[model samples]
Target: MKKSILNLRLFNSQVHSRNVESKEKWLGYLFGPCGALLLNAIMATYLNVYYTDVLKLTAIWGGAFLVMFPLASKIIDAVTNVVMGYVIDRTRTKQGKARPWLLLSAPLVAISGILLFTVPNADLGVQAIWVTISYNLFYSFAFTIYNMSHNLMCPLSTRNTVQRGGLSVFNQISTIMMSGIVVALIFPMAIMPFLGVDKSKWILVMSFFSIVALPLTLLEYYFTKERVTEENVGKEEKKIPFLVQLKVVLSDKYMIIMLVYFLIYTIGTTLKNIGLVYYCNYVLGTYNDGVTQMLVSVIGGVPMGIGIFAVWPLAKKFGKKNVTVVGFLLYALGSAVCWMAPRSLPIVLAGQFIKNIGGLPCAYVFMALFADGLDHIEWKSGIRCDGMAMSLYNIIAVATVGIATAIFNALLSGAGYVAPELVDGVTVAAEQSKTVNDVITFSFVGLETITGLAMAGLLLFLTVEKTIGKKQQKIREYQKAEALARGEEWEEPEVKAAKEEEAFFVESEEIFRQELKLKCEKKGLNYDEELQKHIDKVSLKRKKEAEKKNKAKEKEELRLRRIEEKQREKSARLTPEQRGKKEEKARIRAERDEKKWQEELLKGEAYRAKIQAALAKRTK
Candidate 1:
């Protein structure tokens, strides 16, 4: 049969390398976050500007709602992030724990994202209500589901540190490319120029992303596998209670450091995102043309693109901790450089470039480090806190989005920031007060400096890489003992793969045969006899093929052939009537076997049963 152009099987195949995972899987990992984050990118980069300048929401009560709502959403996020993680940990689905949620959350993520821009045309009170409802729906609920599950995929994908590192890189690249480069860079230059204060254009731009999100998430769900989660299936203690997982996570010192490092770094990035446009509008004097902002973004983005190939290698060689520390310090250095010449576009661009280069390790390798922390927890406590850890990781991550937004809004509002206005049919951005420009500069450049230094200090205590090897070894041994206690054979993944390759009757094949036996019994047929006959037939075919391939061998092979000839001569000594009866019995048996085989093939019952059984296991 010809394969279809859009064959999903190709995407589902497992491909492995010494360091990274399958090509298809990493691609899925790369794009899956892109799906969930596309709209998030818009919100992070443009929503504040939109709320203030376009919707003129800041005009109402000094933009108090803008500042207050995101802060309120963070409170909700604190609860939802934990609950979502706990739910994911307990979820039992055929697609694995995280992947199912990836699929389930896609539509919710899409719909909620579109609704965020669709503020109703009503009074200010009604608009506030719409914005609040839509904001919570996206951040507190829908995005929480997608983001937590997406973040959890790294730890649950594999136990191999190198592969996990590679996945982390892919995950970060997806984030930077969609949220940072594309949304922050291209959208500002291309889309935002056309979307100046037009409410409908914002909806149209968001809608395009909404349409693409569902398929991208589905791609992510299909291509990625949860090998680590699958390993826990049918275990004596399959489900670790949420409290137990939380306790395990909290008890680990490394885990706490990683979480803090992640939180501080995320806050810095969110602040930068929130303040970019304000910086462009007021400081660079490029509100109408986003060229200067785009140029600066592009300059910074170059290092990130290069970091994809460089970060893992550098981390592997220099130790993830040391490399990350250096990166964060460089981040601080870059921020200082920008602060020194806040009014110079060239200086700011240079500083941003330097800062992004410094940002590489944390941007790309944080998850690998976090996964190491999870391994440490598993080693120390014999419980994997993937769900709880990711919940907390995402709580810091998701909450920071709202926290930074609120902070930026409050700061701008307090600084007496001016919104653009319609003049002679063209919407023009208003000149901001000096206080507002200073506030924007600090948010964009100064906050990162403080956060970067803090993160670098926090990373000093993260010495996980030094002991990760020994810890992982102990974890394997612990798992082996647990498996043995449950009467299950424990084998390394490589060893198991080798055995599966060599075996004719694999576990799944035997299970299928058992079903065939039941089917035979239901028809009042002798299953044992049928099974034995099938085995004999397979053995005979294999023997014939082996002999045919070995026919050219010398000396002893000729001697055996003469002996076989002598056996035929001995049989020839029998009487004609005895030979006739023997031949007749052989002919009858061959005819009976052939008839049953043909009947089985013609009915297609055996293969149909086998396929159904396989499908049942896959979906179960």
Candidate 2:
């Protein structure tokens, strides 16, 4: 039986490891930022040029279309995310949980993103509408579907928190690298030329970019994994509604805060994106200055990514909230420096370098707290609720980007910059040539202001209290163990309730988990290795332990029944012989029961000791 149990676990572990490599997980990671980089750079940064210079549309019309692309998509993105979240929460597959949608959405997303830019021919209004509808459809369905299924890959379906964190890091790096290539390389090389001359060339360049980015992004959806396990899954009979899921997620303080942050930040992005082309063309007097803009893109990321590494250590030392505060301050200060720095190219570059280099680290890791916040809700509400939690994050992110563009367009039009009518492939006359620079500069300053405000909103997110330090984590881990002992899902509600009821015990558990975690970190032991060892050792004996306990309970009940029977016999006047015989039987049974209890107690203690020892080894 022991051998069979060991074999079963080994088989399960093997299956889990295999499941970890599902195509969707990696593919989604690769696609999300790469595609974001490509689409945003083109649509946000250069689409105005395409409209005014290439297609020969007026700024009001051109800007209106570009703005509406994201705005129109915002509604669709939200609707799609809610729908996908609902569908994913109810998803099941023999291939393993959420893999079906995750695997399938790649091609659809790739095609839609490409189609938005690759449309052949149509009337201007119709073309604009087509682009708007197509972009919205692609991102709303394809991106949301892919991301919802992707987040399900967390919770160690076949791995652990450490593994998930590692994956997050890997995904961040992979996506950012692609962003660098797309924004830094692609724009300087291709789009700037398209902007310089020839309306026909604009379409040709966009088509080329769409081809390059679409395939690169599709590779991500082709490579990611989706692992599966027993989870606090909503019942098949009582599926969660889309609106309810959206409502619940939005109700979360962190989710609301994230939405605010993204919304505000998107405003900054829109201004910054529009500012880029305008600054190069009108302010700096050459679209060929794309290099400086690319520099800005590269600089923005370096500091943020670097800052992220420091966040974990600082979080361990202080708290997630404190570290985030420090990050926000550093990032904001840097942005201020970059924005306010004088017109010297060297000075601006220096400011940009410092700001981005400082900001990059935090961007990579600190936002993980957003996901961690869901644990508090799970503990409080007894729902794992990944789809709702993650969807909220994505929705805010997508919506804000769209919102930013709309705000930018409104401001641009208000500033009296009409789009140039195209003459062949070039603008017939400059656009608000005299005042465009002022608009560009003022808009940039506003961008700085909005980004700063959004970062402040991110600071408020620390209030959620899901940032479990070492102490709380230990307590939760023990309850998790207890649930496992009772043959319950580790993430189930009863386990959380059981732990919540024992405050002192929980405090001690947390202290223990912390000390051990610190010790492991000091020893440089990987969390994944420790977790894998534990999962490999856990067994069906959890159910067996519950059964043995139940049997012991039954024995006590039987003993009480015998004692009551003897008392009844003794109550009869002529029943002395019967009472005496009953008493004798009762005494014999009691003695036998005592012996059995002692033996079982020893076995139980031994079993618990075995568990403790294994846990110690894993943690140590």
Candidate 3:
């Protein structure tokens, strides 16, 4: 039995499972961003505050310079990002496209992140020059590479929607809970109080994160697999020109929707993160030294953490877009609650908790939805858009930080916001005027309310999921045709996935048997008896897990049932003519969806033919 189990394990290990979910992959995804994002969260949450208060940049450069600097700097990144995306798409190496870039970015991010924080104590002109160069170095160059490559990993790693969703969950958790929560709660609560206005201590703190980032990034690169990227290996297909590919990606309506969605969400969150310090210092009645901000972070972070687990199941049940819409509504509702009493800590915390809960579904599943849009574009265009789509995605992710910061600084400076001053011997926060306080409050909560409502409405037009589902088989056929034209054989993704799943069961059985055999040997017991006991234990555990899942499913069903009952009651109140018109509208909508699907299918066939003919002519 032991020999057979060993043989089975070896066989399973030899059969590579592309896009199959595994513990190592999930861990890599989770740990990859921990170091970098932790540093970034710290910067996003505090760097602006540090510049305004500790460095006293406003004293040197005019107040308008603060607003113009970040916005102007992002213009460089915006252009750089597009060029980098084009370069990444054409780049081929033994380490794969994105991983090689990920590796190169590690040292760059580490060095630049530290330098950005370590602004030298020199002449005002020197300090300003140092800040500009370091800021651009860290954000425009290093962070862009890291962010783009890390995001590209997800779509390239898998085409399987379920596995993609799982990876996305881990990615979001790492960004939100691991990096975000720690920075939000711990940094402000513990570190900020200690650092005070000490620039040397700030450099020390930033350097620690810079040191941590290197190893974590290497681990992520080592463990991540770009399965979809591997699909193109040894195939000599026609390469689309950079400008043309850019046009293709930009013109995809789904990509546009995702870009807009991402921009609004990032801007809203950035505003909150940058404004929270000011809000706590001024609007909350006193500079309680980040204790109030820490409390607020914890209050909000806890619910967001819980909502992470629920996002996947809820998205699976109700669709990603539906879950996201509900989240936006909740966000708006929570913000409205906060608006009722902006100065009250308890009310603010409660509203923050509610708003954070609303943020979870979108935060967790946006990448997955964006990946689906990428797939849809591929289905239509017969090429992948990993680099192009993700570059734009990173642009929004990074640029919004600048946009938010600039907006906050502009408002604060305009309202005669007072920075901390050295009183007697120690630095103390200055009391702000009422207008400054109001601006802080608006940045903290009001921005989110408007963006949330706008996003909820805009997301209604994102219907790529429905189209992608209909075109899945056609996509596989196009891929096969393209590969055939290149004189290579192609295997269906579903077929490969099914084989891997069978190997998974074999591996599982082997492990269970090996463990049982070891236990029997140790105890001087019968292997047969131990095996039977182990099986029974495993069965009991499975039963309990199933019961838990069933209960959750029933609760979801009950909620849906309530919604349906409300709709029925509303329908009963309508006149017969109104009911008939509603039915006609539903019919028209269904017909329109069907018409669009058929049109897309026809277009896909034409594009596939062109690609195949072009490949054939080139081969000849």
Backbone clashes, each candidate = 0, 27, 0
lDDT of each: 0.78, 0.55, 0.80
Ten-residue region with minimum lDDT total, candidate 2? 9-18
Residue range 1-620, candidate 2, lDDT tens digits: 12244233221211222323334345545354365446545665666556545554443364666566668779889877766766666654433345556556656655665666554576776766676667676668776676666555443242234345445555565545655666556676566754564645665666565555555544543454344233322323234455545555665566567556656655665677667666655554445555666655665456544554664555545655565566555556655665674344555556555555534434555445544555544433334467766666667766776776566665666566755445655544464645555667656543564466467556664554332333235335645675677676655443432343355345545675677678779999986677556445444544665587799779979988997898666567547787788779989998986686566446534544654454456555
Q: Rank the candidates by TM-score, best first.
A: 3, 1, 2
TM-score for candidate 2, residues paired by index: 0.65
Where is model 3 poorest over a 10-residue stretch in terms of lDDT?
A: 6-15
TM-score of 1: 0.78
lDDT score for candidate 2 against the true structure: 0.55
Residue-level lDDT of model 1, residues 1-620, one tens digit each, is 11242233333323232223455445677876687777777777887877888788986776788888888888898899899888877776545667667767889998988898999788988988898888889888988888888887888777888778888888888888886677867787888888888888888888888878888887777667676765665564545656667866776678888887878888888898888888877897668586877877887678888888898989987999999999989999999899889888888888988998998998889888888888776666666667788889888987888888888888888888888886765778778888999999998899899998999899999887776776677667767876788788898755653453346246435876798799898998888888887778878976985585577355659977998999799779989998889889989998986686556334433433443355446556
TM-scores for every predicted model: 0.78, 0.65, 0.81
Query: On lDDT, who's better, 2 or 3?
Result: 3
lDDT of 3: 0.80
Cα misplacement distance, residue 158 of candidate 2 (Å): 7.5
Off by over 4 Å in 2: 1-44, 59-70, 95-98, 120-122, 147-160, 194-200, 208-223, 226-238, 241-247, 299-319, 418-435, 457-620
